[model samples]
Target: MLTPDRIDSEASALTGAVRELARRTHFPVSFGGFVDGGNAHISAIHGSRTRSLDGLNVRVMRGLGGRVMAEIRPRATPDYGAARHITHDYDRHILGEGISTLLAVPVIVGGRVRGLLYGGAWASANVGEVVMKPAFQVADALATELRVRDEVERRLATLDGATAPASGALGPASPRAQGGAATPTEPHPSLPAAHREELRESYAELRTIAAAITDPDVRARLAHVEQRLAALSGDDDTAQLTSSVSLSPRETDVLACAAIGATNAQIAAQLSLREGTVKAYLSSAMAKLDASTRHAAVTKARRSGLLP
Candidate 1:
C-alpha cells in the first residue's frame, strides 16, 4: 500500500521518467500531468527555461494536454503558436518557455485517461513517428505506474479500516505478534476469508497486467506489488523468492488468465492460441495443482502464492 513515503517515491520515480524521456528524445523540454478532480495537474517538468508551466492546472479540453486527455489519443502540432485545432489557454506559458512545437500523449489506464505526457521543441518542427512512439511509450509506462499506486493505496485503505477500532475496541494483532516479523507487516489474522480471496484476486490481476505490460519500469513496480501480495497471503520469503511454485510458465500463464475470470475462448483470443490449446494448458495447470475445476485450480494457485 502507498503511504506518504511511497507516494513521494512514486512522484520521484515519475519525475525521473519524464526527465529521461526529455533527455532521450532530444526534446528541449518535457512535462507531464496526472488527472486530479477532472483537471490535468502538471506534476513533473524537465528542461524548462521558464516556470510558467510549473504546477499548471489544465482543465479538460482547455489546452494541449487537456485535449489529449479528452480525446484519449496522442496529439501534436508543428507550430503551437499557430495551431488552430486547440484552445490556446496556455499560450502564454508556451511562448514563455520558447516552445514553438509540442506533442501530447494521453496516459490511459483501464481504458480511461489518467494522465498526459508532453514534449516540446523550441523551433517549429514536426514531431515524427520516431519521437511519437517513445512519447507514447512513456505515457503507457506512467499509466501503469499510476494504476499500481492506486492498487497499493486501496490495499492500504483496507488494512487501515480493518485495524481501526470499532467503538473504542482494540486493533488487530501487531506484526511482531502475528508473524514474528519486525518489518513489512503481515495480513491481519482476524481478516475474513472472503477478504483474503479478494486480495488474492487483485494480486492475480496485477500479475496478469504485469505479464502483458511491455514497459520495463512498470513491470518492475508491479513486481514489487507481487512480492507484497505474497507476504500478505502468508507465503514465506522462500516462496516469494522462488515465486513460481513449480508451475510451468505456460501453466502459470493459463492460470493467470483464469484468475482474472477470463473465459477459455477469451484467453485464447488474448494469447493468440487456439481454444483447444487454451483448454489443454488450463487442464495441465489443474492437473499440476491436483484440482478438479477451474475455480479450484485458481484457489489452489492463490493459496500456493503462484498466481499472484
Candidate 2:
C-alpha cells in the first residue's frame, strides 16, 4: 500500500510527465493519471480550455483512454466523435473540451499497464510517428520512475519489518528501534546474512534508478535513500574512515555496482556510462581508497562505510 506522501509524489510525477508530453507533441491539451481501483482518474491536466476534463474517471474498455489502458498500447482517433470503434462514454467530457483528434498511450511497467497519458487537439489532425514517438518516450520515462518508486518503497517496508521487535524479544532492534530514534554514533544492529545481501542489492538498484531519472529532486531523494541503506550495515568500526575517505557520488555508484560483482560493461550499462568511463571512475575510487584492484576497492569501500 502507498502512503499519502507516496501517492502525492506519484501524482506529481504524472503531472510533470503530462506537461512534458504536451510540450513535446505540441498538443493543445494533455493529461493523465495512474490506475486505482480499476479506474484511471484524470488528476493532471495541461492546456485545458475548460473544466470538462477535470476529475474525470475513465473506466477500462469504456472510452478512448480506457481502451488504451485495456489494450496496453497507443491508440488515437483523427476524428474522435465520428470514430465508431471506441465507445462514447467520455464524449461529454472529451468532446466538451473541443478535442477533435486525440491520442492515448499506456504507461507500462513490468509488463503491466500502470497508467495512461493522453494528448489531444481541438482541430482534427493526423497523429503520426513524429508525435506518437515523443508521447511514447514520455510514457516510458514515467513508467521507469514509477517502477523505481515501487522498488524503493518495497525495500523500505522490508527493512522496517526486519528491524521490528520479534515476538518474545525484550526490545526492538537498535537501527529501527521502537521509538525510531537512534544517536548519530549508535551502531546499527547486525542484519541477517540474507537481509544484508538484500540491502546491497537495493543500494545498487537505487543507483541505477538515479542514473536514469531526469528530475534532480527525485534523484537527490534516491541518493538520500542510498545513504540510509549504506548506514544500515552496522559498520560502526569504519566511522572514522568514512569521514577520512571521500568518494564522489558517481565513483561511489560505480563501486557499489562492482561490490555486487558486476563487470565493467555491466556497470557501464547500469549507470549509463561508457565502459571506459566506468574504468576511470573505478580507478579514481581505487586511488582514493588506496586499493590495488576493483575487488579491493569494493572491500575498502565497504569497510569505509561508503557502500551498504
Candidate 3:
C-alpha cells in the first residue's frame, strides 16, 4: 500500500539490499545500477576504492554489466582482466574496483531490462552459484518491485489521458435535433473507447501487481488504486449530465473507503464504526446510487461528481 513516494523509497532500498548481500556472500563489494536509454548508470556502490565506476555509464553490450543487459540474465567472470568473451570497454573502471571476480544480474520487469544488481570480490575466487544465486534472488525481488512502479506510472498516464478535457465534456455533443435542427446521438458520458480500453488494460495490470505483492500493507495500497480505476470507469447519463445522484454523509464516507478497495472490516476500523454499520452505510449508498455492487456505487458516485 505504498504511495508513489513510498514505492520510490522501496526501489531505492535496493542499494542497501545489495550491500547486505555482498557482505553475507563473502563478496566485499556490491553496487546497484539502472539502465537508461543505451547506457547503464551506476547509482549505488559499496566497498569500492577508486570510485571510478560511480555514476559511470556502461554502453549496451560493451562491458560486463552491459552484456547482462543484452542477454537479459545473470552473468559472471572469475577474472575481469582475463575474460575474453566480454568487451574490455569497462576494463579501466572494473580494474579500478580491485576485484578479481564480478557478477551482474539484469533487473527485468514487464519483459524489459530495467536495471542491474552487481557483486564483486577482492580475492581471486570464482563467482559461482554461491555468489550468483543470492544476487539473482535480489534481482528477482527487485523486478517485482519495479513492476509495481511501472504499473503505477502507467495508471497515472491512463488517468491523465482519460480525465484531461473540458469538465463534463462527455465526448461530443452529438448534433442538434431532427425538426429543422439536427439529430443528437447518444453521448458517451465516459472515456472514449480507446482511452477506456487503455484504462481497462492498466487496471488489469495493477490487479496483477497487487496479487503479486506479498506485503499486506502494500497489497492494500494497490487495492485502493484498483478501486479508483474502477470508479473512473463508471458511466451514467443522469449522473454525468444532471448530477442527480445523492448520498448521506455516512454513505459518502463509506463509499469513498470502498472506492479504494477497502474491505468492510478495514473500512470499519478506519472509520471507527462497527463492521455491520459500515456494511449498512455501503448498502444505503449503493441503493441510493442504484448500483448493484460496491464498485458500481463508487463509479456512479464519481460520475455524479460526488467523489474525487
> How many pairs of residues in model 1 come into backbone collision?
0
**Per-residue lDDT over 198-221 for candidate 2, one digit per residue giving the tens place of the 0 to 100 score:** 888888888877877777667766
By lDDT rank, best first, the candidates go: 2, 1, 3
> For all candidates, what are the clash counts?
0, 0, 5
Please give the lDDT score at residue 186 for candidate 3: 32
Model 2: residue 52 alpha-carbon error in angstroms: 1.4
TM-score of each: 0.64, 0.90, 0.61
- How far is 300's C-alpha from truth in model 2 (Å)? 2.3
**Maximum-lDDT candidate:** 2
Query: What shift in Å separates residue 122 of candidate 1 from its native position after superposition?
Result: 0.9
Residue-level lDDT tens digits of model 1 in 1-308: 33676667667766876886797678989988767789988899998988988767888888777788788899999899889899998888887888988988888889988777789989999888899888777777677677766775676466445434355333356542332322332333344566656666766666656656665655666666556554555433322222234777567767877876889998777676789988998898888888899998877775665654
> Candidate 3: how many backbone clashes?
5
Better of 1 and 2 by lDDT: 2
Off by over 4 Å in 1: 1-3, 156-196, 199-308
| Candidate 3: worst-modelled 10 consecutive residues by lDDT | 176-185
Better of 1 and 2 by TM-score: 2
Q: Tens-digit lDDT track for model 3 on 123-145? A: 77776676677777778877777
